[model samples]
Target chain A: MSEVFIFATLNGLVTGLLLFMLASGLTLIFSMMGVLNFAHASFYMLGAYFAYTISGVIGFWGGLLFAPLIVGAIGAIVERYGLRRVHASGHVAELVFTFGLAFLIEELVQFFWGRDTKNYQSPEIFDFALFSLFGQEFSAYRGFMIFIAIAIFAGLYVVLTRSRVGIIIQAAISHPNTVANLGHNVPFIFMCVFGTGTALAGIAGVIAGPVLTTFPGMATVLGSIVFIIVVIGGLGSLPGALIASLLVGLLQSYAIASDVGMPELLTLLGISFDRNHPLNDLWTLNLPQIAPVLPYLLLVLVLIFKPTGLMGNREE
Target chain B: MTMLKVSNLHAFYDKSHILQGVNFHVNAGEIVSLLGRNGVGRSTTVKTIMGEVEPKGSIEFKGEEIAGLKPFQIAHRGLGYVPENRDIFPTLTVRQNLILGLKGKEENGRWTIDDMFSMFPNLATRADVPGGVLSGGEQQMLCMCRTLMGDPELIMIDEPTEGLAPKVVEQIAVLLQEIASRGVSILLVEQKLSIALKISQRLYVMGHGKVVYEGTPSSLLEAHDVRAEWLEV
Candidate 1:
């Protein structure tokens, strides 16, 4: 039981960190544009699909290198031609455009990838076990994922905080006018940031697809969950997203690992429920059965109590 | 020859006709002030010139029509605008904000970070601090410095001393005089006539979107009726 708890916790931490990868990009986009991207998860799906197709022709490593490039290019083009055109219409129109885009991308995936789950298996190089803890082997691919996520996070932090381009991007988010006055091309920067953010989402999707399953509905499954993570962490707060992802991951993992349920609570409270009762099903619900809803529950609780999120300075 | 010429400029916000057939001209190396009461379209005129608003007129800078250009495009063409609100990037440090204006790949390369810092020493100390934390006077200085980083042939500053301490306003007047001395044409949109008169070589009193009066700052000071009717804020 103890081993299961520890293993589940570790796996949850991994999952949460990966989710943060998607959420961070979404929050950046939101802070700059002031619109939550409804199709952020769709970009993730597109990344996975792009990788899947590329890996077949060029191998897994090459796919990892090229897929995000392709995805980022597509995102840039979309932002320049589509989002920029619709910006004058206000935030609702932008949100709707992304929502419609999410739907269209899902359909596009079905048309191109043929409505079936692609065998997006991990690379042969990372198929072996990296190490074993308490008689359980940690797959090399999962370990690779942890490394990539951390590296990307560090790289993003540096680019956003240390480099000249990063400084311009950060400035553009708050004072695009000032940045432009400094002889910088603000619109081009916006296009680049949007592209980079989408590409990051794509990278996350590419690695997560094999483990999480890649299909037409892959985007639908994780789309809102990423938003939830971002909102729970606080909009535009990088550290908050990291913290929230881990919190959600651990909470859900514990919920799944523990065997306690409503029955245990009921037994402890000395309450007896008849099988004939109309609410019998609710009383018999198990901890594992409710694990999937934990994130949404936390999201609601956070929204109610702390609207700015865990670290967000601005309210949604 | 005029560095910038505006002819029959008309602008609207929704259905409101804010700038009603405005016309103006700024010669090179002159500090021109646009004086008007609140809600009289002074800021609107500036926004229109920067392409931050859709305006119906012709605005030519360096002899090219730029009324239809976007804000970024206008800035790319050696035109700098310090908006009424300053609009400093809150998340970015002062140095970063200053550097942001240095994006154009132009040859003239007029202003540098050191130039701005030299002009505003208070900013040099807060180079690492975000613009959001600065005092009103410091933020105003940062906004001007940020614009100067663009190396603009012309700079349109809206209300440089609208809300500030008397000392800060005095500092701003000195800064404006210094900037004007550097051969850059500056359009100072100000409510404070005394400060504008002190720095600007030329002045235009605007009312209902039209340039009601234009002359040397001495003439504007002499015209008591125009100041009373159009600029007695």
Candidate 2:
């Protein structure tokens, strides 16, 4: 039981960090541009598909290296031609533009890659188990994924806080007009930020593709969850996103791992529900059964109780 | 040398015409003030000249045509603007704010970070603090100092001392003189006629988006009717 709990925790950490990779970019873009890219997950899907195609030619390492670049370029073009044009129409228009973009990209992906899931596989080098605990083996690729996520997070923190470009970007986030008046090309900065953000999301898709399976529906499956993480962590906050990602990841992991639930609670309390009860589903629901809905449930709770999210700056 | 020349400039905020044929000039090493009431288009004049507002007519900076250019483009061409409502990056430290003011290639401007700190000791003490946490006077000082770091040939400062303690206003006056002494031309938009008369080499009293009075400080001081009709509340 303890071993199961321990493995679940480790898995949770992996999932949480993976979620952070996507959330960090979303938060960064939001802070800078004040617009949430609804199609962010579509870029991630493109990353995976791009990587799969590239890997067939030059192997996984080459695919990993080039896929994000391609995605980043595509993201920059989209910003320059699509979002920037819609921006003048106001926030709703921008949101609708991205929402439509996600649908368009999905159709494009299916047209190009087909509706079937790609046989995306982890690199042969990372296929072996790193260690065996309690007769269960953890793949080295999972370890690699965790390492990459941590490195990206650390790198992002340093780049935002310690570098010259970071300071300018940070200043631009709050005072764009003043930044322009100071002679910084504010629009150029916005374009770069948008590109970088999508690139980060692309990287997340590349690594998670093999583990989660690459398919047309992969983006739709993860899109709402990623959006939840950003909102739960506090929109436009890096640290908040980090905490919230791990929280959701671990909570879901533990829930899925545990067998305890409504039935167990009722049994402990010496109360029994009738088979004919209308709330039979609720009465019999276990932790594993509830795992899928945990994130949404938490999101609702957070919104009702703490609308700014755990670390969001109070809205003006 | 004439640092800036504006002739028959027309600007609008949507359908409402704000600056109607506004004209003004500032020479190198000279301090010129645009004095007017709240809605008399003094801010719009500077904003239009800074390329914040799209204006119709000619605006020459150092004899180069600058109308219809983007704000950053105008700024890159040696024009600095300190807006009426001081827009500081609230999250950034004072030092970082000043650093952002540094030009890309020519970083060694006329003013150093230390010079700004020494001139405004309040800023030096709060150098590490975020701009949002600073008092209004400190933010105004920071806004001015940050623009100075860009080393502009001519700066158009819009209401540098609007809502401030008397001492800070005096400090701003002294700083403006220091800026002029360093050979940087100034186009000041001010509401307080006393400060304008004391610091400005030439004054342009604006009413209804046009220059109602343009004269030397002494000449304007002697004209009671100009002050009574246009400047006085």
Q: RMSD of each candidate?
A: 2.3, 1.3
B137, model 2: CA deviation in Å?
1.9
What proportion of true contacts does candidate 2 retain?
0.72
The candidate that achieves the highest DockQ relative to the unseen native structure: 2
Tens digits of per-residue lDDT for model 2, A152-248: 8899999898777898899898778888988889999999999999999999999999999999999998899999999999988889999999999
Report the C-alpha lDDT of model 1 over A1-316, residue by residue, as the tens digit. 8899888988987898788779878887887767688988999999999999999999888888898899889999989999999999998999999999999999999999989899998898998988888999889898888888888788878988888787777767776765655556777877887898899899988999889988999888888888899999998877888888889888888888888999999999999889789999999998999999999999999999999999988843
- Per-residue alpha-carbon lDDT of model 1 for B1-233, expressed as tens digits? 78999999999899988899999999999899998888788999988888878979899999999988878788878788888888888878898777666654332476778777887889998999988899999999998887877778899999989789999999998888888888889999987787888888888888887899989888877888887888785
How does candidate 2 score on lDDT? Answer: 0.92
Say which candidate scores most in lDDT: 2
Interface root-mean-square deviation, candidate 1: 2.5
Candidate 1: segments with Cα more than 4 A from true spot: A176-183, A272-278, B104-108
The list of candidate 2 runs beyond 4 A from truth reads A276-278
> How many clashes does each candidate structure show, in the order listed?
6, 0
